[model samples]
Target: MGNKLFAAICYGENGKKILTVKCEPEFGIYLRENYSDITLGYYMNKVHWNSFDLNGNVPEMIIKDMIEQSINWY
Candidate 1:
């Protein structure tokens, strides 16, 4: 299977997703088109999200930065 990069804003008892981060396929993911300019993430459904595939095309640091940006999607 192709490696897909996904992310989501996670929530807890506090009632808000404290942060966002890369998500394993099994865990589900979301997407938000307005999140970034170059990159795009979309809402998976109601609560989870995902990002565009890295496809091993960009450098590792860029991917890392994308993950970092996702983490700050709060």
Candidate 2:
């Protein structure tokens, strides 16, 4: 990606895999509303980042889409 967007992966206190990605706050709002597992970025800025379970019920393709979309947000 040409943009310098920040992204990362880290484990939470519960030992679950978390994927953090940079994204538009508006889009993050949409995802948070539609996906039950999405949360305001874990230990990150809520408006610029989002974090979700790598193995949760949000579906595999959607997660992949999110990851791809995130890298392009900036």
- Best-performing candidate as measured by lDDT: 2
Q: How well does candidate 2 match the true structure in TM-score terms?
A: 0.83
Query: Candidate 2, after superposition: displacement of residue 68 in Å?
Result: 1.3
Q: List model 1 lDDT by residue over 1-74, tens digit each.
A: 13443455544334533233443333332223333312322344433434443332334564576576545544
The C-alpha RMSD in Å for every predicted model, in order, reads 13.6, 1.9
Best by TM-score: 2
* Model 1 spans with C-alpha error above 4 angstroms: 1-51
What Cα-based lDDT does every candidate model obtain? 0.41, 0.84
Per-residue lDDT tens digits for candidate 2, residues 1-74, read: 76475678889978999889877778899989999998989989888889998887888877877888886665
**Residue range with the least summed lDDT across 10 consecutive positions in model 1:** 29-38
- Per-prediction tally of clashes: 11, 0
